[model samples]
Target chain A: MKKLMNDPERIVSSFLDGLVAANGTLIQRLEGTDVIVRRSSPPQKVGLVSGGGSGHEPAHAGYVGKGMLDAAVAGEVFTSPGADQFFAAIQAADQGEGVLLLIKNYNGDVMNGEMAQEMAEAEGIKTEMVIINDDVAVNDPDQRRGIAGTVLVQKITGALAETGASLQDAKRIAEKTVSRVRSMSVALTPCTLPAVAQPSFDLAEDEMEVGIGIHGERGMDRREVASSEKTAQLLLESVLKEIPSAAPLALLINGMGSTPLMEQHVFANDVIKQLDRDIQHTYVGDYMTSLDMAGVSLTLLAVDDELSSYLQAPVHTVQWTQC
Target chain B: MKKLMNDPERIVSSFLDGLVAANGTLIQRLEGTDVIVRRSSPPQKVGLVSGGGSGHEPAHAGYVGKGMLDAAVAGEVFTSPGADQFFAAIQAADQGEGVLLLIKNYNGDVMNGEMAQEMAEAEGIKTEMVIINDDVAVNDPDQRRGIAGTVLVQKITGALAETGASLQDAKRIAEKTVSRVRSMSVALTPCTLPAVAQPSFDLAEDEMEVGIGIHGERGMDRREVASSEKTAQLLLESVLKEIPSAAPLALLINGMGSTPLMEQHVFANDVIKQLDRDIQHTYVGDYMTSLDMAGVSLTLLAVDDELSSYLQAPVHTVQWTQC
Candidate 1:
């Protein structure tokens, strides 16, 4: 893989180093840990922490700010962070108000996050948690994988925390958002892990992978390569089939890196036209990306008055800002 | 070439439609021209107008706002806009104060922008022009190509225009910026034009093009693939050789689409470590991209008290923002 990196083994550490350096004004990495936290934290506000792997960037760490996540613990590319790091992030973000751990539903992530919660509680940190499983590609809700929908969770719940809400209140918002969000992606190309020179999976020139996961996880099926119209139809319909909402919603068209914004915009245009409900808000850009995978994912969140208020709230992060 | 697009002929039009639709709150397209204007323009300030080809999205269009260009005209992918559209942009952005035309130094863009300037004058609107040619790869200083350095010009000059400066003052700042800025790029993969299915050029697994242009034009030379450190060393040395400034400066590490943030961040990390002068500011991202080209370019603008003041001024647009 022709990637701009130093050593393959240093990808995660050096990336965090570069990220903290680039955005040092707003964020800082915890000393000797893989956790990133706000440069300065207000002690009385409820703390919110979310994280998963490193490859899906601008997701967990990029959301750290005053009105969003307080801290983000990063794992190796597509690998879950150890419990020790998660515990450290909780301690760094935790204030007198309490801490909330936002976990995506993956085996390693859930195990480590839960362990961190137990450890924090033993220290009387008053921490609670919410695990996101919003990807509808899988038939079982419990079996669903979390994808770009986690960003909506981060935004809405983080906004909730910004209001001086109690830990329970923040947990309630996370659960509410978890129930209303759905996401799925189609991959035109597979991304190779830096440590491994070859792509994780292979697709012929005339094929596409459907319902793919962020970590290059196998999708439900593969299909013939087709026009953008056909790709949008499949993803939009798959999302609708799983969770059809009659309420106004928010749409996020996320690029799996290497997909240009031009194509993302085209895919977003197709997605919105096929949606059946009123789109109260639309986010079309590269919010969360899988490393150099030329694909896009569609995320829909059912937004009522309350959800819309949180989504529209002011936020300033490195990769995202809405005034 | 694989891409997420509808009809090849309608790529530019549909992409603009999606852009306007997605960023409805920030920008709007003029009635029939390939021109984008701010949703609402404040008429008293000296208006800033810029246009060139499409594909380098979020460049001219995304910079349209209260503190930046009042309007931006776009042409087809890598193709200059027709004179008719440039004229329409001039008319749309013109206010009683005057209008400043920011043209990138390309034969077609220069010809069409100049034509539009004459047409605007015929209609009795005061107009000023600045053509930027900051690429150092071409030895002929008069014929050096314009690349990502134009964004710095737009930001600084546009900020000047926002301060209610006279047309003459804005023109002066643009000229000063053009003089101090120098840039060069390296491409790991070639970009394919939508109208044509093939990439502009070819590269083997172990080769890369140095000093490449935004439109995949020939660079200074090619060499076997090297480490990221080597890449940064070559680019930074080449830029220093041509411009060689002793003053503090701003650094921009721009990605030519398809390069991930992780890679961009790595490249930026390397660039900063090699620089000898004080870096007043650093911007690392996909500022001005060539369509799906897996590459990056480095731009250095020698900054003094005056230029630094304009560079740090707060301006919010769709793709970039600082509070």
Candidate 2:
């Protein structure tokens, strides 16, 4: 409860203000809504846009730049932006070529993105949608919540878009990337909401909640806390079962907020040590987060040569970038 | 007390292993030492080498790349690297143009850096040192512990070194940056050392430690918890007192390990709203950290045209990059 915020109700707006202030030259805020867009984009290329609740740092907003999201429509923490806001974002992101919306598989996000796409299409802006459902914890893929694999989706598609791919082509790549990536997360501690002064959930000192969703949704079960080695094995085992022989994949050891890079790196090392497949690349840091949750998630993206090229494409962004 | 580490005794080396696992292509680990060096460097350019402890990640190691430090030596958590390790870094970084060692002004760091400099000089590699003492919290500037401002010193000097500046020129610019920048920090909670089960210190529920050092060193005073506005005002006022009337300075709002980016951004917003001077630039996030400490430090680097140019210069590293 000792967070540095202005007013509980003002957390969303104030955080957006700070985002703009920190990267003013790189991003431009929409006049009214909680939206941030690239300062300038090529008019003849397909534009990319993605967004959701605000608590996940760098997920939607940090990807809004040259090689990733063209615009990000933000809602309150763990809440979706209004459909009208998403429509406005579509309008802002529509280059003459068209626009593609990257929506995570959350109910509110899906609804708003669908509505915005419809609205933009009616306005003759030519819009498409690619819903990402890469979380493997849920029994049904459609019901699975999107997690860190969403970044890989945005990244590969964004890089493809940077190559002047059409809306159809970018959407195709996005859908293909989505099919190849799978992610799962476990939380050692729960995050507190600004609107609520208490944590969303709690665990005992020696226990952890496994298979937890990003928004503190119920996971599979709770278990006694173990060494990072055991933790990495358990998380990776869940992911490896889906594609046992998918060698030469990219690994993303993402921190679910409040986990320091020291521990993230340690967990990453354990993941590598415990992995059975060949890793082409490993990304370690905070890409998506639950507000102050201290935990780590492992994401594996099955990358072929074409997907590898897209992953290697140079990107300049506020958060994720490559030289 | 839950962290994703194998053993507290081996955290330093294991963390370094993970760092290389994540960025193996960009760096190489020195044999038998806890030092990582950029794989390649321009032989004609002055090289930069920095090291202290393992906890302030992305500071020394994350900064090692084409346009930054050529080598970064890491030590045990909250401790200084051995003098031998620094010497190895200097040797690894020394090109024909010579090398410059950037050392923070902690007692252990300064002592080891000086010893390393002597060893490197005895071996006939041209070497110079610039000790960073930018903390405004401590009354005596010479004895002040270097904190986040040390990164500014590395970045500006690294950019200058990229321009093929001579050893003397790079050293001079680093010294100038160290003199111009001043910083202060406040912590809501104390960091727990991995080697120790308990926190370095304790704070009451309604209390905070102002001006705390990165390694949980005691600050000037402990006061009742204040709003982000009041906290920002107090930290900035202390930094501004040392550098009155200085405008157009780059602001670095750094997080101690466990603070969420959402809160950091909120704090950054408050800093802008409360600042009396016009800010030229603002960089926010966990550049330097105490191990899993929930707090922030504000660094103001007074910049003119030359310093501004260096700050804008393009560099590529694992953690930091400018497009």
Candidate 3:
């Protein structure tokens, strides 16, 4: 595969240099640290921080802004950020108020964010953490992996923090959102990592893998490609059956990476049809995307009035903006 | 080539049904029309409308909500919505105030949206239109093709409309945003249409195309695959050379459907590094994605104080929310 780098090993560092250069007014990087913080963070607002592997653009870092996360630590592609990096993010984002660490359910993410939280607490900062495990495609519900639903948790909890909600309140909201959300994905094709220059997995021309996790993790079943309608039905059914909520909901039809907006919208149309209840709102796009993999995921947040209102609150970020 | 559908022709309708089902409470469709509008749009607000081919997801439709677009008309995959569909969207979204149509500069989109505006005006509803031709990559500066920068036009204009800006005022803002914005894209691989089940263009394993447009449109040049850093440099250099602007800019590092977020972020870092001036904000992700095609685009919006403040304002939509 042809690529655009002088050295494969330095791609990540070089990319960071470019980001700092281009967005210096809004974002600042801590020297010798992978953490990026908003340049306009207020002095006393409780800080919200998040990070993970680097492949998900407009994610861990893109979300760092005024009303969302205060800082994001980025690791190399598909790898967890170091604990020290997470520590740096916490320090940069911390205001006089407390800080909240929003960790996804991936083992590396959980461990790294947790370790950072511990380190921050040791340094006399009041640090709280929430692990978002919202994916329903896993074999065991208790061990369900995190997927796109983490975005919702971050948005809701981030909105709370922006509104000066206490750290405990933000944690409560984050935990609640995570509990009420469920996500499942299907991959039409595997993506190639720039470093590897090969597909993560082999997919037959006529086949697809359903219930996939974000990192190209295999799901429970593999099958021949179905029509967009059938695929949407399958995904929606999985989410509805697992979420255990009978109230109004918010649906997210997210692209893993390479799926076009056309396919995602088509799939979203199908998923919406299968839903039997009134949906309070819906988000159909590549919100929590995988790297250039061709796939889509369905995320349902069974929301109450509070969550619904919070979901509608305004936020400002690089990729998403809402009032 | 396996796909899920009872019949290929029914794919669009079926998907629409599902979307309505999933967002019945937050949005509603014009009967017998492919237009989706927010459920709570008051009759007094000036409606902001945008639409185009279907491949761009979470775009015209996902943006329908408070502080964004009032309605989105969808066409078939990569095809412009029909005149009737655009007309329906206008009628459904129109309030007592006039409606503003933000049309991309594609031939079909402009023609169809124009027809819709005329029809709405004939029905005694005031309507205005602005054509977005922000892409600088196509080499025809005067007749430059509209590309991803259309999204920025939709956003700034939508914010104006939501804040009760007059239809003329919103049109002016939309036009100014388009005038000040520039975009360039590169495709690593051609995207396959679902119906065709093959790539739109043939790209060698080690080849890439620069200055590509959204709909498989030809680019300025095709070259062998380079490293991510070089690719970023090539794209950025082209954009900067074409449209020189001062510091404090809004940058969009967008993904073509199939490129992974890792690659997108990697490229974003490179572009950021090359930029010498202040960047007010940066948007990195798949904002205006092509179908499952592996590529990325860079968009620059020169940020004036008004544009920057407007960009910083809160917005809420299915795909994006900013507080």
* Candidate that beats the other on DockQ, 2 or 3, i.e. the better one: 2
Best by lDDT: 2
lDDT of 3: 0.77
- Best-first order by lDDT: 2, 1, 3
Looking at model 2, what is the TM-score of chain A? 0.98
The estimated TM-scores of all candidates read 0.98, 0.98, 0.84
Better of 1 and 3 by DockQ: 1
Provide DockQ values for all models, in the order shown.
0.70, 0.78, 0.42
Best by DockQ: 2
Scored by Cα lDDT, where does model 2 land? 0.88
Taking all chains together, the TM-score of candidate 1 against the true structure is 0.98
lDDT of 1 at A317: 75
* Tens digit per residue, CA lDDT, model 2, A106-134: 99999988888888888999988999887
Chain B fold agreement for model 2, TM-score: 0.98
Model 1 CA deviation exceeding 4 Å by range: B242-244
Q: Report lDDT (Cα) of residue A10, candidate 1.
A: 82
Per-residue C-alpha lDDT of model 2 across residues B91-178, encoded as one tens digit per residue: 8888777889999998898899889989988999898999999889999987988899999899899999988899999999999999
DockQ of candidate 3, scored on C-alphas against the true complex (2 decimals): 0.42
Docking class of 1: medium
Q: Give the Å shift of residue A302 in candidate 2.
A: 0.5
Binned by DockQ into CAPRI classes (incorrect, acceptable, medium, high), candidate 3 is acceptable
